[model samples]
Target: MYTCAACNEHYCRRGELEKTPSNCPCNETEEVEKFKELYLQEENYKLSYNSALVEAEGYCKKTRLEEIMDFANKCDFKKLGIAFCVGLNQEAKKLAQILKENGFEVCSIICKNGSIPKEFLNIKEHQKVRPGNFEAICNPIGQAMFLNNEKTDLNIILGLCVGHDSLFIKYSEAPVTVFAVKDRVLAHNPLGALYLSDSYYKDKLHKK
Candidate 1:
């Protein structure tokens, strides 16, 4: 059994630990700090970032919106990319409009851009979650390739399905930010599972 010092909870498995920092009283601060210094200080690629740390330090007196605008101004990032699922098309269009209004050149790609069938990949017909006899294969690679061709400075994801999102991120040349994650039951809010875990998701904890 693993005993959590901060929470005083005895858990059976080491791998089943909760991510909450208070759950781990035995601090690994030195190891974490050493890794951070190596990655953030020593890496040449890490030095090139105009990251959230710069925006948060009162170097710019703006809110997040204003800070993003300031960063965009400083970087002169003329082209932006949006990679979205077909289910979230309306939201994506609205978001694209907003980005354009904020003086960005936007290129948007839908997940079903090529409209290939899922069954062609040997997916069972009955196993289809959204069974309409017409299922479109999520083409995350295509979206990334399209955006890469457009030479976007940044790419944003809106409501991409779990594995598809990973593929999109893997293939994207530009930096990626998630606007929404796909969680149909909880309305795109994945944290709802964490919050309501005791009541609605107790099975998740018991599976191990």
Candidate 2:
């Protein structure tokens, strides 16, 4: 019942809840206080503070690439890792080159690196994108393990499939950030669905 998105009266900004709706989670002050304690940790504090500074300084002034570099530099990260889908190999290569040029040691791993077949996961032939073909399963775990072995300071996700990306993040030892998402029909920009929610894609998204 959390309806913050639908709320117009944002009382949270002023640290007050006089106008907060009935379903607002701000009413759970104890839980909020408990979670806020996490920010007191040294590492967590630096991450939260630096992330805010990055957002404030880069607002409308820098590209996402520049913002990422600024954050990495602030964090003093030297070794970076990229976990990418097979379809985005070229893009991953370009990103790797850019990171290397920026003075970061980059390690890139393809989703199909281990080359394990989908059959290992008990996936049926009918579920295959191309049936009767020897297709390799996307090994997000392998990508994370390889990067962890290399002791990467930061990990970037490039076009991993929906569930695969989650697995990679869960297994990654270092903090992870998404560089890009896969949206084949919209050139990897998934927000296209939201942008067209009231237009061409309205009927598809809001079926009556």
* Candidate number of the best TM-score: 2
| Residue 154 lDDT, candidate 1, scale 0-100 | 79
In model 1, residue pairs whose N, Cα or C atoms come closer than 3 Å (at least 3 residues apart or on different chains), thus clashing, are: none
Which digits, one per residue and each the tens of the lDDT, describe model 1 over residues 1-208? 3245445444324544455344353345577577667766633234345554445554646564455545555556778899999889999998889889988999999999888898878888887876668887899999999999999987888999999999999999987777789999889888999898887788975575
Across 112-202, the per-residue lDDT of candidate 2 in tens digits comes to 9978999999999999999999999999999999999999988999999999999999999999988899999889999999999999899
TM-score of each: 0.72, 0.94
Question: Could you say which candidate leads in lDDT?
Answer: 2
lDDT of the candidates, in the order given: 0.77, 0.92
lDDT at position 82, candidate 2: 95
Error of 2 at 130 (Å): 1.3
RMSD (Cα, Å) of candidate 1? Answer: 6.9
